[model samples]
Target: MSAMNAPLDLPLHAATLNPFIAQAWRERITPALVDYIAIPAKSPMFDADWQAHGLIDRVVRDAATWVESRKVPGLTLEVLRLESRTPVLFFEVEATQSVPTGAQAPTILIYGHLDKQPEFSGWRADLGPWTPKIDAGKLYGRGGADDGYAIYAAVSAIEAVKAQGALHPRIVGLIETCEESGSFDLPIYLEALRPRLGEVSLVVCLDSGAGNYDQLWLTTSLRGNVTGTLKVEVLTEGVHSGDGSGLVPSSFRVLRQVLDRLEDARSGHLLPGAFHCEIPVERIDQAKVAAQALGESVWKNYPWACGADGGLTLPVSDDPVELLLNRTWRPTLSITGVDGIPPLAQAGNVLRPFTAFKLSLRLPPLIEGHEAAVKLKTLLEDNAPYNARVTFEPDGRVGAWGASGWNAPTLAPWLERAMDAASRQHFGAPLGYIGQGGTIPLMNLLQQGFPQAQMMVCGVLGPKSNAHGPNEFLHLDYAERLTASVAQVIAAHP
Candidate 1:
């Protein structure tokens, strides 16, 4: 398990290490990685009772200890407090080798979060969500894949390169714990460490995914997200359903009618002016390639209710490109949850007096966050059918970001080559580029700060990885291979 073993004499480039080093790295890391996956650092959003749970502090201290023990050549490890109450463990690993003279190499930055989504109990067989269990080549645990292993993977990759005396580029691992909750505290932490986060040229984020386990998915764009609560008051108090059936206007009905005005029920397209955006030509091309690779398995892989009409109600694009473009480059609205409504088991024969719903809006990268929010709120407020008292309050918002046109010429090829090498070594196929549906707000901010820096977003969450849902698991072999791929990217940077 030690990273200091004599470095293998393999060539540092992708073609040089392709078939052999990639497999060796996966075999070496698989066993010890399970222990790293067992920590339960559930996100603060779902684990509001985190302090009483005791896992948060344990996970942080464990990571700090791991970083300290490594003694990376010039790096300093310390657990510092940001904003007095927020505990942030900072690991500053300095560059080991001097840059070649006259070389315009920029200091590469790698970012990941240690926190994970909450895991509910009741898994099948003997599996418990918190207990790390490896079955059929998959690692089942809460934070194992979402991002817990990203920091370890990044450091391990660099260490492997260093062992070979092939380490030339400067890599800094910027690990955080609040990414799951909209990364609310990141800007503050970034400001506090402004002096130390110097001269960055490239940022590598292992927080996203590919469409499948076969290809290395590179994210070119991210959708912005806005979440808020909408409350509608229809009556002063609840009334008997039999008596109020026709007379009283139910809040649920009013809410549904208002939402219908904002979206087309059949096509799922946003109403005019809700938000404006253009789908990029590059994204459209990438989606088409991904769809062809996925095939019919795409629809069959979804874990939905049994006997559900698979293709009847579900809309399938004429081609894979359209499907991928709709998900990545377009705006979407969904009703996440409703409050003031009792479950079927607690059902009562009464018309509810008031109902509130949580709505989530995903905006295209071209739209501004605040502007989208304002447009959505205005649309909903104006369309209220029953003149119901409707109120919209912002819960959380993260702006969408378009990829900078500068770095792609250089960074994209490096990533594609690294991914192709890994995939050919592991699965005997070439890697591909794909667009993701989720948002990583910090990527846009970091890009803004260092306009000239190259950026690449890569990770291990593919279809059925179920990041924020029940039975979340990380494909063990895929993650290990991904770690090796990251190593290749760092070593191959020229």
Candidate 2:
């Protein structure tokens, strides 16, 4: 967005790019994506019997079939399955433009995933997670924007480039179905397919969020995640509350006390020093810029409940920049799921034996996820309140922990110029940079493997296009322009 950013090269068929992508989404991708949304292909964590359901397999096969049917020039698609892991769809588009003599063409690795989060509660009367509907030009459904649209957009971008007979390099797409579950299965496939995944100079990950739908936003960093269940037990069996009132300690109260060690209940700040990291100066500056680009909408966009007195409810801070830093650069804790609680209607005056809560801790980008998980387990499980039995069990391999976060390498000058050029060409605005609070395990993996690769991490999860929550929708107009923007970047790739 700066005055020095590279000016756009005459767009290779710029006049027709949007029309081509728009038609592609309307006639080809949307219908298929609709079917994709309807499948309820929840991630493995949500559906333990995913294999028996066969939904993952069906969606993979369908996506593979659609790609093959595209018949793009020099394109070959494969649905790769590792004995027990979820499937990944890998496709390649050979270089089209003549490469300079003595220079190997650079490879562009476009990454996304087909897996989706579980169908959470609180859907609108007309909308459901699996029911795809088009209202007001947005496609309402889960997974459609979160990532099911990635492969479709990736191929369509290639097609747009080829349709113009534009100069383009080798491009490969890696769409896995386990991303929502921390991408636990991806490392294996990355190793097995390492040889095939050529010198990847660029990674176009279309699974992050945008500051807004008005302009292009690049994710500069992502927070890591550590999730596990913490349970506290004080009694072997349930007893009437009146009878056990004074004798037995409350499991819920004891569990809360243990969690107090990890987080400040009132302020919501994670207490451990290991969970915090130094916020890079560049990221702080970018957050300020992004905060300006998107003002109060940064936090006000969230659906917070009204206060008891009918006044507005507030976030941790009202400062836009601080809120941005808090979500992206700082660590926080959330209780996602719970057990050992009775429904209000079924509430018996009984003392429960145990209380378990699913804890999801978001860590700063530099903190190691597994190490944090280990530390969290120790912090909570060590000191027993009233000597109550408290245990912390984490998800993922014991040593590996959950997903570690990623901070992208320094932006390459060429890629920065290309991105700004693409943004100007498509959205009539400069490109924006923001750090996303969500974790993308694959980004860290790819950065570790290709340390020099410039990451183009952008997506359609802008404003209220909630990916995991109900009423999720994909802004069709923005997506169409974004598709064209991606094509522009690829055409500008050196």
Q: Relative to the unseen true structure, what is the C-alpha lDDT of residue 291 in candidate 1, on a scale of 0 to 100? A: 81
Q: Candidate 2's residue-wise lDDT over 1-494, tens digit each?
A: 55336778745667788889989999999999999999999999999999999999998999999999999999999999899899999999998776778876689999999999999999999999999999999999989999899999999999999999888889999999999988899999999999899889999999999998888888999999999999999999999999998899999999989988988998998788989999999999999999898999998888988899997798889899999999999999989999989889998999999999999999999998988888888899996999999999998876788788999898877788878878888888988899999999999999999997889999999999988999999999899988998998898888
TM-scores vs. true structure, each candidate: 0.86, 0.98
> In candidate 1, which residue pairs clash?
none
Which candidate has the highest lDDT of all? 2
Q: What is the lDDT of residue 53 in candidate 1?
A: 79
Range of the 10 consecutive residues with the lowest summed lDDT in candidate 2: 1-10
TM-score of candidate 2 to 2 decimals = 0.98
User: Candidate 1 on 341-433: residue-level lDDT in tens?
Assistant: 999999899999989998878777766666667766777787466778888776553452121111132344444555566555545566667
* Candidate lDDT values, in order: 0.69, 0.91
